[model samples]
Target: MNLKNKIVTVIGLGNSGVNAANLLSDAGAVVRATDSQDTPATREAQAALEKRNIKVEIGGHTENFIKGSRLIVVSPGVKESSVALQWAKEHHITIISELELGFRFSKGRIIAVTGTNGKSTVTTLIGEILKSGGKDTVVCGNIGNSLCQEIARIKDDTWVVIEVSSFQLERIEKFRPEIALILNITDDHMDRYNNFNDYFSVKSKIFRNQTADDILILNYDAPYLRDLKKKTRSNVIFYSKKEGSSDAYVKDGWVTCVSEGKIRRIARISDIRLKGAHNLENVLASAIAGLRAGVREDSIGRTVKNFIGLEHRFETVDTIDGVEYVDDSKGTTVDSTCRALESCDRPVILIAGGRDKLSDYTVIRGILRERVRQVILIGEAKERIRSSLDGTVESIFADTMPQAVELAGRFAKGGEIVLLSPMCSSFDMFRDYKHRGEVFKEAVKKLKTRRVPI
Candidate 1:
């Protein structure tokens, strides 16, 4: 893995690419980074890379910059279909994901979590539990902070807890984690992947390099994952909300884990601070990984109990005139939004729609009928969502977040909820889900001010 005097090109000048370039430069690799677009953040990243003697090409990728490179490191955002990547392939240039590059340079064991949903929650929980048990833990990847940036900080005993995505997994080569958890895979990222099976295959790459000594945790509730035992050599463990017949399950009102032929209670169902059955699955998966990683039961319990959940995932913005405004902008798929809707006890006025992922919104028809009172649609996917949910629920279309919040506020009455759980990506309007969630919160805040008696 000696990178001295080697030529390397990094595709996509996002945070991960910039970090990769810097790390490669530090390792004495001559790095050239390229991106299709130039932004303020990318510019800052470019300047930082330039200080390290790394060349950066923005606005478009150039073939000359990619040619004769010893290796090409791809950021998750970059597609395999990119012309430069295709050229690299044709030229027999070694191309690896940023995840792989990070792993090659990092020391100690790694715990990687991947899934369509609940990756961040599970990754964070695992990091927290490990830290609580006195383990040196560094959490990074997809959640934020590229793994390459944290690789230098890894010590012999450090536990690298990373939230991996299918995009990252798609390009992985020898990027095996000591402990790998696939929370659940549903129809997601259809816009990027050709089909659902293609997406699932990319996710399965996470376990490709795992050996029998490693451990892999999966969701038993997902039928697609039930038969993955044959796919990997690693010891497979299943976590489910149902009782009995799994490595981790809820029985007698407690989240229990079967380890070393002994059943142990990790935490009570009521003790989990995060709402929803989906979160219960997250806790169960994390608890198994925690216990397997040598974290004490008390430490796992304490972490889960205290974990308030991540922002933008079922996050409560504020209560205005007895109506609760929940920001679930992280619900970037139909299944995620349905789970959010199912988790709610009160009737909801759901604010949904964004850049559609080619998801079948009809999958959540039953939940929409049972939980949602009225649906306020926004963003590019509004019409598609409305068409899918036309007869299932009452609908309203708004052009902006403020308009959506105002409309929801009008429809929402006392004891009801106004939820922003857009079942689509926020790229059409906002920079990302976090930005979308922030805007939704700001709009809700303004709604409160408007309704306040001066």
Candidate 2:
């Protein structure tokens, strides 16, 4: 772990990569960073890194720069197929993920959360529970700031709750969470991976380094995850919606946990503030992690009762002429959108389709036919979604977010819902999911003053 005067190359100059570069330089490494993008953000990052005397290259990568580095640190956004990474692999350079780099420098016990969905919610909630229990906690990784950004502040007793993606787990050598939670695995990031099993295998790496002393919390309900405990060395804790055979389960209308042969009630089903059954699963997983971390049962219950959830995931934007507009722009996969559709009690005018993830659009047909009255398609995968949902619901195309909002308002009647739950990634039309959610919200705000047919 001694980095003094060691050569290191960081791939991708995004938030994680920038932080990784600065951290490496601070650790006395001869840091060299590269990013394929040369946008304003990367330019700013480049200026900051140069000030620290870290050599940086943006707009493209060079094989020579990568070849000279003895070690390579990769940000999650950098693809495995990246030329620099491929070159490093070919040359037998030691490569690791940004998550692994941060883990090596971290002085805290980590509670890492990963899954296709609900990772942010569960990760943040665990931090809240630990904080309420009076534990020093820092929440970072995929949800908020990069883990490397918070590394210097974390102490030996600090509880680091990180939301890890499959990409972050790909290059780990010794990164292991003290408490690991995989919410559930479903169809996601299909384009980045060769197939579904490839994505699933990467996510399983989160616990590959965990030992018998560590805890691995998994969803007992997800068929793909039910038997995953056998693959890990960590002590497995199963959270389930069912009544029996789980460490955390719902029974007699209360969320209960069986710990040390004693049944502890965490919260009532009606007491959870977050909407959706998926969120209930998140709370269950968080509760188990909290108990394992020695968080008081009362603290766990209190946090779940008050946690309303993060923005852009089932957030009620506004009601225009009684037609409620909801923002679920964070739904970036077919499975997540189906869950969103399931959560809606009213008929929906669904705004979907973004950058395609190679998800099978037809899997959402049953939910669309059940709850959705219309589908407004946008982004690169609009035509594919339209074709997949052809017989299930009436589908239309909108050129922009505002147009989509207008079209939904025109077609939606009072008591109906206009839900922005894109079943694909947001990269096609927006900077990220947050940006996509903001645009959807702003469009809804603008539509409030315009009178539409009820």
Off by over 4 Å in 1: none
Give the whole-model CA lDDT for all candidates, comma-separated. 0.91, 0.92
Model 1 C-alpha lDDT per residue in residues 1-454, reported as the tens digit of each score: 8989999999998888888988998899988999888888888888888888788888888888889999999999887689989989889999999999999999979999999999998999899999999999999999989899998889989999999999888788889899999988899988899999999999999899999999999899998898899888999999888975689999999999988888989888887889888999999999999999998888888888999999999999999999999999999988899889888999999999999889988898899899989999998888988888779999989999999999999999999999999999999999999999999999999999989997
Q: What is the TM-score of each candidate against the true structure?
A: 0.98, 0.98
lDDT of 2 at 65: 86
TM-score of candidate 1 against the unseen true structure: 0.98
In Å, residue 387's CA in model 1 sits off its true spot by: 1.8
lDDT of 1 at 44: 84
For candidate 1, the C-alpha RMSD (Å) to the true structure equals 1.1
> Over the stretch 1-454, how does candidate 2's per-residue lDDT look in tens digits?
7988999999999999999998998899999999988999999999999999999999998889899788999999888789998999889999999999999999999999999999988988999999999999999999989989998899999999999999899999999899999888988888899998999999999999889999999899997897887888899989899977689998998999987788999999898889888888988999989999998788899999999999999999988788899999999989889889889999999999899988989999988889999899999999988888878888999999999999999999999999999988898899999999999999998888666546
The residue pairs found clashing in candidate 1 are none
